[model samples]
Target: MPFDDFAHNPRTLLHIAGALRNRGVSPLELFRRVGVPPSALLDANGWVPRQLCFALSEEAGIVSGDRFLISKIGASFELVDFGPWGRTIAGARSVGEACAVAANNVELLHQGSALRFFTFARHAELRFEYHGRLGASPHQHLLGSMVFLRKIALLAKVPEAVSVRLSIPYSHGAECLEETCGPRLEFGCDYDSIVIDRSILDASIGDVGPNPIEVAETAEATGALLKRLLPYGRANLETVAAHLRVSARTVQRRLRDWGFSFEEILDDVRRTEATRHVISGENSAIEIAFLLGYSDPAHFTRAFRRWTGMPPRDYARAFRSNYS
Candidate 1:
């Protein structure tokens, strides 16, 4: 797949980066190894190669004993693109109807993640399984998956989830995990899963007051916007403007109205992805630097230090220590 086609959402990348940082991998080094320029981390509209993304995950697995990339990039869930889909679910007459919509049409929004709903008379369960081989840094994927599911449930207004499960092993932040999972999370399970009361699935969504046609149009517009901004991992303002057949000034103004600059969004993407690679401990810092397009390891090192306060080696060591 083209690097830019991977749907460059910075928030997703940020979650990945934060996971790696927590595990002791320098974000800059990870970016460098992945062939992403350090500057890209700051370019809100920048994109990175999909191969590099996979590589980061693979390397993390080797170094960190976790395969987060598979769950993160391989899995399909997106909040930005979910505007219409969420509205559709929100407009559903009942919980089962909403879930049916999610089951049948999630592909209309995202293709990477799978949603399975098991409805029994008394209880209902929703299991989101990420398809594909596990990446080196799966913890980032796990965390992101959890967060995404929680958000979905919250948006759907499920009264409460009975439990949440993760396939990856436990980490240091139990308290934080509980806070994120809402006091009913069960970690270290066979699969990443969530259990909800069946009654919630029957509850009416009420009116969200959005037109389905307008929502669909908005989704299409957003997809087109992402395509232009992320074009195959080459995210320069000029390039983006050219792709959109618009002037650079117009693009800048549009982004400004969104309360972000292209540069800021791109940087966020790079840093976020770098963190995921670093934490997974699957790739060498040198390799990651090269993958990210940094010719000089020293430059990568300096940047990594700035991003995570430690060199790549130290970061990897710390991550292994905590998890192993």
Candidate 2:
């Protein structure tokens, strides 16, 4: 569980399932290979561990015999796949503007990775990078993203100006990439990027409009995300921000606008939930501590004292005696 805290939108897995179905592979196979329960995607906006997704991509390659399977998935990329994030991207006035939005908000759509849009001279690049711990096998994401990125350029009538750049070498599935992505797909490169002509950056995509979502709705959404992530994502400010897919400062500012602080909200949530568990008498103090995001039972004891003016054991014993 070294990297278990990293998570992504479950929509990605559903997208993979649809693509696998197209290739005559059973979607259930994804769960078997990754050993995660099918219920993981039950919530419409819940988060899934990012490593499970990466492992599924790798396994999907084996079961389907197409390492380029992810590229095939990206080939059909639609704005809807990104949910509200897609709607925001669709509102950008130009290709470059969209790229800028994508760079700033990649975490809203995907966590545990980075995306950047930059220009040098006559060419511009949208670069995607995974922290080195992921190793090279996960390059399918780079391939799939490049294919999808090319579509953005195509919207501007400049598909020819777009090419793929991946640090991975040409191998098993490179031929399939060459056929679909054209010869511009280069392997063993220095970066994973979507290269475009600088001037094409000015190509119009849509009319500029105000963002469709409001700050208050975002604050409520943050609280909802916190409720879901508290059990697995941890209750710390940084972890909550990561799950909200926004910066910690942004999370703090939003919570403040709602007249609440992150610590206040987290403490209240923990108290309500932990109080219920202690009263129910179903789980031990240590188990409740772990569920409350405490690494040590002592931490939970201190917190329980702060919440109820007694340690967890005393509170639980008192509750049981009243019922008995």
Candidate 3:
């Protein structure tokens, strides 16, 4: 399949790229192997193709010579590692509130994944629905959920021993899962969930100091950006302002305050999208030009050169040579 079918947060891939880069791996080669364009990392609100996520995970395992690399990487993720979404969770009043926020907004982290919260008299469970691609391992999903829940507990100052337990769908030797997470690993379970003591639910968040106002401001800025890119191909000022239910002057003023302009945002998105399409080794410059709203091939060629300091053909060649 081509790289355009499924989309996900590009942050994970950026993290993987950084890790691999530190280990003397060529980032371009990694992107080539995964059929992702390197430019996808620049736009924080942008999504990369999901196939790239799977390929990067598989390649990370192969390169590191560690079959458990997925879990290891996921376990090492910090609360701040999740960007704005993590801050939103951290800004909540309590652990339970954070869990609810995460549950409600998991799509901001990963598009196809779901986090469900269930509360009982004694405990609460955070269940994860990975919705991973066929034949892809679910270890990353499991460990990520565990680490996220553990961080929540830690942030809330809950005792480690009795506060949280983990249940996973697959049995990866009780000892291994126990070591990756903590002691309480229930393998061979129907769902991947983290069990937490309900008593800790109301505990005030202690160490992870967060500013709710910052979170809201960030969200507002992000929403404006998303609004500009809605339908992607149509990125005019009037349309975006209407979509945001505001006047064009207001939208312009707000984005200007944030050091943004509609033309700049549209051009950035087109550049990113154009790079992805070109690197797939499927579309020609002419096809991609039209696909990205450029009616004139010469105009697109100039814009791409301005964005990348090279012609699209040359850029595509460099990307292809990485894998070849």
Candidate 4:
């Protein structure tokens, strides 16, 4: 198989960077070995040459010196890291629904693989098939992804997962991989795929699955809602949820999925607004505190201390002294 005609997401390399760090491998050294720039490691917004992504991943695997690096990548992969594609799948009510959602959004990843959902008389399969395999890196990359999909199935209590497919020939070392891939695994297959019992398709994701609000876009929306509610001093969970037209409990759950607490969002809003008003010199500390919904100036002082390591006035003075 050829390597450079297509494009691939750079996030795989970003994940590899984390894996390398975990194994005491310097990302800088890996980047040098792979001949990719450090800045490009984080350039996940667009696609790069297919060859480069695989090279980085393969090099990272070598540098980490960890045989279980693919499993490590899967273990650390979070819903948020997948961005909108991940959130949409996680938001599905059922396994089939999630698979359907994933099926629809496969192109967004451009990860040198295609996903197709199939229904048989006995079961349904969410297949991750590579377009072509140039080397070991492609299978390694796809295996990490399959493990994540399998994790979702396990989380949803799917009792039967058929196995994982690998493009390489079978070997003794591959047996140890079952711990990460679960009990079933196949080797030397044309593609990598996951199979689960058809009965589990209709099963609900319940509280165990990731929430859609975990996506950064949704997190920003939550932040926007908090900004508007802060002046009311009731920027607490219930009030913000009311503004969002979602139940308070849902708001809490979704924010937790977004990796933040309501209090953290509220504090961030207060700190940001406080800094702005203070820097603008448009209001007294008391007025700024009131505007930030603090009942007392002392509370704002304490918060500013926690945020900037200095009281508001002292920081304001320092800000001016430095800028003036």
Candidate 5:
């Protein structure tokens, strides 16, 4: 799948482009290989596939220790299509209803993840769990979720009583952290979560329609379709087409209509897995390269440099710097 289909915003691509440039790779070459128009990066509001995003990361050699290329990419951009959902959600009758709408419609924004919403007497909590390897970093999902929550509050025009709880320790410094999540932000938590005051649930959403249940159903259907199309470990055009009882040609044509090729999709899946391996620190660069099907360490190095600007060693060093 094209990364354009999975990304919430195009600016993430720009960040990757910049990182690639830093590593001595030509951004235009990377964009061409990934099938992204060079100009699309400037339009921050545009969307791309999450898989493409991961492929770009792999191409950039971002897989590994401390630099958090994914978080930087995600954080650098604002959510596209967020405004429409925000408008619809803000009109909801209560915080509960708004949370429900957000929970329902999130798949419209990104499908490789799952969300759970819980309503308690005192607070409403939203938890995001990613079902696949994210292109940038594991924590990218958490940061992206936080950004989504922040956008939701902005769209709802609610008082900013919402706060985020994160599993990673704060590395961006106290001031930057406070600015990002509000003074209420808490890090080094067991999991990532967003909490909203229960009183917000009582607020009336005058413009919301009465058919949230129907909308929720439609959202679910959309989510299912997105999940079917996304690149995953089990995904191969032939395998998918076989299961769907369609010819591989038909599958290729269908994905072509969406501007992606099967090779691109498989490359994305491999790239995402490669990043995960790098972050876990369980494999050498050469091993990871081979695991992803590269013929040798040199080819992996060349490919990694193309994907991320830094060499694998330097990328890993930067990534670990934040953790240390």
Candidate 6:
């Protein structure tokens, strides 16, 4: 995958840096070890490298000499730390509603993983599964998530009397697990999950004072605008901003903070659609060019060459001849 696809919100890294600083560990040194620049932490809307985020969390455990460093950080994490998504979660009426919001919109915070929520006879489970292996980082990811889930449950004001257990796929030394997360750790489990009392699911967290319908509408609109150029569309920053009732410059700066550019996203869309059109053999180069919004066939050819290292005709020929 392209590095851009691996991007995630920078707040994750910023929070980790704050945690490391509190422990007297230099986050700069950790970033250096992981090959990420120190300046990346400053961008409020910036996306930190996905690999580096995991590496930093893993390194924090090693450098701080705390086996549960990730859990500590996650436990301390506040809903507001998640920005708008956190507010959406905070406004949810019940634990299940909150988990649903987090599970559905997790990619808005980090594109690396998927979250699932389930309810059984006596337990409500929140599960985390990454899209791919992160080498030694799953330990951190799983442990951090264990604490993060517990924190969210607590935020729902679930009673202390409720029983909660954590099931993890890895065995992280039983003593350390118990010492850090209490006696409810179940190792060698089928997944990383948080199990809480099912009764807590309906426990009201109170009205959070925002209209859920309005919040959902706003989130959907922003998501649609950001993804407008994908698959097939011609949308630039100015056009998108106009649609969103915002200034083009404001859109540009916000996109910058999110680790994307109007041009780059448009290019990605074109590159993807162009490749598909070529491979499918459904459109001539000129037709594809016109469909892709190019005025000149020659200009489209040049762009296609830049995208694929070959002319469109050659690429199509190679693709069809192989399958035929």
Per-model CA lDDT versus the true structure: 0.54, 0.70, 0.64, 0.68, 0.56, 0.65
Q: Which candidate number has the best TM-score?
A: 2
Model 3 ranges off by over 4 Å? 1-6, 132-135, 159-179, 209-324
What TM-score does model 6 achieve against the real structure? 0.58
- List clashing residue pairs in candidate 6: 45-257
Tens digit of per-residue lDDT, candidate 2, span 1-324: 245566677555545664565677766545645754444443436677766777777777778888788878777566555666667678788888888877888777676778889989989888988653663266666667677766665557766788888788777746778655767878888988888888888888853334433333444565566567666746678876786688999888765543345675676667777889999888999898878777888988998898789987789889888989
Which candidate number maximizes lDDT?
A: 2
Which portions of model 1 show Cα errors greater than 4 Å? 1-84, 108-112, 156-162, 206-324
Using lDDT as the yardstick, the better of models 3 and 5 is 3
lDDT of 1 at 229: 47
TM-score for each candidate, following the candidate numbering:
0.48, 0.61, 0.61, 0.60, 0.45, 0.58
Error of 1 at 85 (Å): 3.9
Query: For model 1, what is the alpha-carbon lDDT of residue 180?
Result: 54
lDDT of 6: 0.65
**Tens digits of per-residue lDDT for model 1 on 20-71?**
5456665556656676543442333444443455555556544555544334
lDDT of 5 by residue, 1-324 (tens): 433334655433434554454555565566667666443432334566666655655555443332444444444433332445555576677666777787887765555666678878788778776665565554544564575565444434565768788778877643455545566778788767777787676666454323322222222222233234443324455666666566778766544332334555455445445556777788998788766666677877776676667677877778889889
Write the residue-wise lDDT of candidate 3 on 1-324 in tens digits: 332444677555435554555566665565655666554554567886665576667777678665656666666566665677777887889888988988897788676677898899898877876564634554554464565566665665655623334444454454665555667666666766777888888887855643332322332454445434533456577766676677878766654433334455556567677778878968888887777766688988999998778999899999889979
lDDT of 1: 0.54
User: Per-residue error at 78 for model 2, in Å?
Assistant: 0.5
Better of 1 and 2 by lDDT: 2
Tens-digit lDDT track for model 4 on 256-317? 54344566566666776788898988899999888888898899899999878998888889
Q: Over 4 Å off in model 6, which ranges?
A: 1-4, 133-136, 159-173, 178-180, 206-324
Candidate 4 lDDT at 178 equals 80
Instruction: Give the CA lDDT, 0 to 100, for residue 213 in model 2.
Output: 30
